[model samples]
Target: MTKNIEHQFSMLVREIRKEFVGNGPKEISTRFVGSWAVSEMKGNLTNIEKFMMGSKEGEKMVHEARTGLVKKIYSDLSVRRKFEDLAGAAILRIFSDIDIEADIAMTIFVFDRPLISKEK
Candidate 1:
């Protein structure tokens, strides 16, 4: 299962990189961080058993994370300026292809409101 998930993640990276960089360089400097990175960071916080039991909720969470990370990559001004509008359009295209609830997906991707006060 881990291997399959890793493979899927790699495929996603390749797809996004192809859209963003074409065949120009092996690496391109961009502020758009990979969703896999976000997933890895947050996945540990998510309970696997709970996720399995709450399949619908789990799917929602996963979809939101995917959409949100993509949006962040596309919307970051520094990143967008470097990649041009193609990044934004590519993100939209990817999101459109996904069958998940569109409004919820978009909302999840939109920038979150900043905390008014820092937690101590």
Candidate 2:
């Protein structure tokens, strides 16, 4: 299972590098824990629309893209094959809200078992 997870993570890194960098350099890190996948990336997005990402509209665009990235990851074949449920996720904060150059982290719930709630 560890090997499989590593392989899946590698595939994800490949996708990220291909889609964002296009044979360029980008810092990326990923981890898999108990059906949860986390990815931290920096220098992923080059520019915002046409202007710099520090602009007001650029921040909005990044926020919107963060939402869309969830759907995009879930749609991936590797991600889809790992876990069956993607309804209620945990933390999925990709792209820095302040600057596009900042590190972005993406966390996926990817729960394979039933979620349990504690009753007080």
TM of each candidate vs. truth: 0.31, 0.52
Give the worst 10-residue stretch by lDDT in candidate 2.
90-99
lDDT of 1 by residue, 1-120 (tens): 434443443344445535653421132121223321211111112244235435787667766565565565556565534322322222222221123432211112111222122349
How high is the CA lDDT of each candidate model? 0.35, 0.49
* Per-residue C-alpha lDDT of model 2 across residues 1-120, encoded as one tens digit per residue: 555554555465557446643532265555655445555555555444325456787767866675566467556665554333332334332222223445454444445432333349
The clash count of every prediction, one per candidate, is 0, 0
Clashing pairs in 2: none
- At residue 59, what lDDT does model 1 achieve? 66
Candidate No. with top lDDT: 2
- Looking at candidate 1, the ten consecutive residues that score lowest on lDDT are 36-45
Report the lDDT of model 2 for residue 19. Answer: 61
Q: Give the TM-score of candidate 2.
A: 0.52
